[model samples]
Target: MLEYLPILYSIFLVISLCSSIILLIPKVSLNYVRIHIGVLTLPPLVALLALIFHVDNIIWGPLHFNTLTWLMAVFVLTVGLIVQRFSVHFLVGDRSYRQYFSLLTLTTAAGSLAWLSDDLRLLLICWGTTLLGLTLTIRLKKEWQVAKKAASTMGRYFTISWFVLLAAILWLTQTTGYWQLSQVMTQDSLALLETWEKTCINLLLVISVLIPAGQWPFQRWILDSAVAPTPISAVMHAGIVNAGGILLTLFAPLFNGSIAQIPLLILASVSVLIGTGIMFVQVDYKRQLVGSTIAQMGFMLIQCALGAYIAAIIHAVLHGLFKSTLFLQAGSALHHDQPLKKSKKPASFIGKFSGIMFGILAAIGFWAASPEDAYQLISAIILGFSVSFAWMQLIVFGHGRIGRISGLILFIAGALVYGLVHTGFHHLLHETIGTGAQPSIPAFLCLMFILFIGSAIGLWLSRNRTSRGFTILYLWLVQLGEPNQAAVESHPKYLTQYMSQGGKKDEFSINIK
Candidate 1:
């Protein structure tokens, strides 16, 4: 019975691909395609429920259906459903609608294959297929030069990422003689390798994950990909790009307690700061969203680096849901955004002290929710920072008693959700795919200190942005982050005409292009 579960989604993918090909017929119509997509979503949802109900790995041949893989399957199918549904209405008049749907289904299938495979070589192949699907999707609108540039840039990066992952897989197979991920992860292969070889392999895997995730130097590709259709954007942000977190989480055994963790941590931290800094300066909504995603990916990587693989997976899933919805609803900004408020001075000493108390509560909540054996440093620092940031913002920036109370309630609620979800995922992964041990205490403490210092600096800057010294720094960040004015000015006349008529290019603001 358990062995059969692995083939269920494979059957669905075949049905979907056949349906997609059939729909390409001019007389077939899109109503059937929409219904097929809805049906396609059921297998993953059912598989996820089965996994939740039965706490055991389902391994049949080269397929592995674990808690993490099932969860990823659900995510991929959900994204496919949403994107296909959106396309039903969004691409009603587009000439390449059939091509888009075909690629969408293919991409979803590839993603499923990547997550569900127990074989490292098969995972690499699936991942590469997924990347190819994304590149085609990005270039869906062949006439759009910006889309072409974005797709070209992403293609180059994807190629590099593919090679890196391929190299990592080859090295792993050669070193351990194990093609099965389950077997490979169980052995301490790193211990058997030389220091240089270990570092090289880990670094390759890190870049392979982070580059596709739109971190730092590679972020521009994603930001530029805004020219792709909104449906593509929905799937890209929601399903495809989030694969990096899943990749790192799936390979937690590679880095947990290893020397490679520190470099990955530093890379993640830098991405978090720089990506978030750019978000603050971007006036364009899509650019801001891209920046936000970069920061979000960085944060997820940080969790992975800290031996908090469960937290990273949860973050990726949640972020995917939110970002997909946002992309789908990008045209209706009037309904979602709140009016901006003016900045104010920092909180008084008494208010600051209150924040400290809230921070303490946050720490307690996180500690209580996590497994007893889990790493303490991450939970402590996250709880402390959440409390401090919440307290400061609520006390100083919040409008009144009601605002402060609401803020506190939200923080408490968030902490509870964080704790419960993290615990569930952690337990699930522990049973299905064993995680790495916690980093050394001293290393954990160092991370905590660094994060808190960053929080402190952010607090100070928020309180005194009007000061000339800090103002200069803020201006520089804005200048560095803002989209090029010349590029915006050079928007093609034909593209603008198409956009004005409500074409597939959903982002239409004059400032953003």
Candidate 2:
């Protein structure tokens, strides 16, 4: 019982259960939702503070309760509070407020549980429940057709992912004959898993990981679900999306040898490339952010697959915090009716210039320090640049002129720096591939070349300032309604359909009766 303090500290469950009950009460009012939201915010902060003070004693069995989990919990709670505050303004007196708060609490609780869960079963259950809660919250906003569709799609995706996870767990239990995570992580357990049954379990595990991490076909749900409200979007990306990666980290030791490493790397790489490309074409503010989340998650997964568990976890937390903040800001901007336009003259040129300079410094540092792994490092740098470029393009398309130019400049510079780092790293790797050679001049040259090209492109593109075809194509695709001609032609049909569906007649109503 004492061992479960970390799990118990999850404030969301209490809030969710109580909010649901309150919603059903005859006398309860919309104010109850605000009360619950307020209630839900405390547990995470309390737990985080507790963890920080007692950093050493929080461990329970396989779960190590420490500053990292606490920090993440703090972040989740902070975001939820901000979201709730914003939502209150829009949802004042709205009857569904209780339902919304309930779902929000549930989502946060699920995230906390996933972060704190010591076992795979507990983690998986929490994750699936969180996804379900998010879907239900979206469904509750039935007035928004787009939100409804997004919810439906999310529901299906989550259902399939959880099913895969369950199957994997079952397979693992059958092979190991134990459900405890500690048993599974042992050398004896791994040796037992070398059998045919265990092999099947491993395959299922991989599939399960792919599903939630938004790899391949399963990724569409994430994109579709971005149509949800801002708070929901932030929760999903920052909290829910972090689940699979956290699970992978918990079970990293189980994935030793080539069997797990090679396939995982391949999947991560594929997700990174495909997700980044798709993001480049997205125009909607939320959808572009969602694609960026997917791409970043892929990169995190790649780090995990490469045995860089620490890096992956750090990236996940950092990305979640930054992305959630951005989403919130974007929502605020939209609410204020800010004009999201493309400026002919790029904004933030100084910032882009600074980023480029920093990238150069990083590339040089890596070249001077580690010559042997230069190639792999260089590849990572290039990949990072490509991803950044795609993300910038997304921002530009969604927000227009100033956003577009600033994002483009930043992306171009970032990408170039990444490329330089890759070049230097690659050269280093080649020099030390077989022998134990140290630093190499070739790596430094490669880094320099990458920086030069990146800087040159940044300068050239900034001056050129031509509207790209992709931007126009994206605008057409994501524009909420048809052009004037289509709007005119569809108006009558739309009205007829609405009337047929028993929509309430307004002042402009024509009485068919």
Candidate 3:
């Protein structure tokens, strides 16, 4: 029965594809399609619970099912169901409404299969299909030239990323004499490669993941893609951007002692800083979300660099949940945001001190709890800082004592929730994502120090915003977050066609102002 699970999951994927094709029919009731797709997502999630007590990896032909596979399947399919269900009504009356659902289903199903693939060739094909599906969805609004340009940019980058991954896989297969990802990474086969061969392969692998994850230079593609439909943006940011961490986790063994770690750490650090800056500087709602995705993906990659694959998986899944919800409600956010901006003044020195103190206490507590685990130490410091930042902004800096008190309560509740969730994930993935890839303690500490230094510099600059350095950094981040000119327009081009089709004369005759 367990052996058939892989086949059963493939059947689900096939059904999803067939359903998507049916969705293209003009007469099909979208309500029925929404119900069907949403229901389809339930079985996989329910099936995952059964696997909680069954831990062994299942393999059949080109596919493999394990803890991580099940987890990602749950993520992609769940997000797909939500986005499609929401779009059924949310996108009503749009020109390409039908095509949107079809493309989204295709992308989601293909992405789900990609991670389950055991053969590198199969993974490449499935992942490529996913990327192609996403590109088409972005270009669905063909009436808008900006949308077309954005789609084109994404297509080009995705193409490069796909083929670079292909090249890396082919190189490894040729060297290790196996196309199966699991077999290729086996100790005996991995030992077949010279140190330089392993390093080159890892570097190429890093580049491929970087483009999709939208770190640093490659981030422009995602920033441009903000012009896509809301559901598309949600799935892309919430599901697809997390692909980097997933890829790295699957290939963790390759980076056991590779030099690629240096570049990976450096680039991801830069991406984190730039992404954070972009998030702070951008006022556009969707663009701000995209910036946060960039930074979140950077942190995911950093977790991968630290050889904490399980932690990265947890981060990806949680971030996807929150970011997707934000994107779903993005329509109302433009109106709802005015209420969230009540605290306009800078946080006081006492607020800053309290935040830092809390961070120190949190780090010490975590370290004392688990002094033997180096990864936990690094994780503790990062999470501690995050807690401090949140406390300062949400609790300490508020204008009213009631609001601050309310925030403090919510903050503690959030921490409890996070702790419970993290423990659950660790139990699920710790065995699957092995901790064999340890890092040099001294080097890792040095990298952490540099990261903290960068954070400190940013903090100092935020205080003295009128300084030339701050001004230069602020303008640079703004410029970085700005989409390409071709991808930006005064208004949606489809509006003209819509009005031309049928609109009240008054709306059509309104003054140009």
Q: Write the per-residue lDDT of candidate 3 for residues 1-513, one digit (tens) a residue.
A: 666666766776787778778877767765556556665675466447536656358787897888888889888988888898787667776667668888988898889889989999889999999999999998887889999999999999999999899999999999889989889878999999999998899999999999999998799899999888888988998889899999998999887667788788888888888898899999999989988988889889888887888888999999999999999999887675455555378678888899999988988888888677667788788878888988987798765999999889988998999889988888887888877467667547756876888879988997898999999988988999999999899988678877786865532142211
Candidate 1 Cα deviation (angstroms), residue 482: 4.0
Taking all chains together, each candidate's TM-score versus the true structure is 0.86, 0.68, 0.92
TM-score of 2: 0.68
Best by TM-score: 3
Q: After superposition, how far is residue 436 of candidate 1 from its true place, in Å?
A: 1.8
Once all C-alphas are superposed, what RMSD does model 1 give against the true structure?
Answer: 4.8
Model 1 Cα shift for residue 453 (angstroms): 4.8
Give candidate 2's whole-model lDDT: 0.61
**1-513: candidate 1 lDDT, tens digit per residue:** 655666766777778778778877777755666666766776666667657676348787777877778888888887887788778767765667778888888898889889989988889888999999999987877776667677888899899999999998898778877899888776575456667776778788898988899886677677777667888988888887888878877777776676777766776776777778888888777777777888889888877877767777888888999998988888886544686757786678888877788788767765776546445546665667767886687544677888778877877687688668777767766665555577765556556666677767888988897888678878876775654442343665656777687645422121211
User: In candidate 1, which residue ranges exceed 4 Å CA deviation?
Assistant: 1-3, 188-192, 335-352, 364-375, 391-415, 440-453, 466-472, 483-490, 496-513
lDDT of 2 by residue, 379-473 (tens): 44654454544653444243667776787687668668755754543342222121222224443343446345545654664566565744554
Provide the clashing-pair count of each candidate structure. Answer: 0, 16, 0
Lowest summed lDDT window (length 10), candidate 3: 504-513
Model 3 stretches astray by more than 4 angstroms: 1-3, 53-55, 336-354, 372-374, 398-405, 441-446, 503-513
Alpha-carbon RMSD, each predicted model: 4.8, 9.9, 4.1
For model 3 the local lDDT of residue 363 reads 84
Model 1: ten consecutive residues of lowest lDDT: 504-513
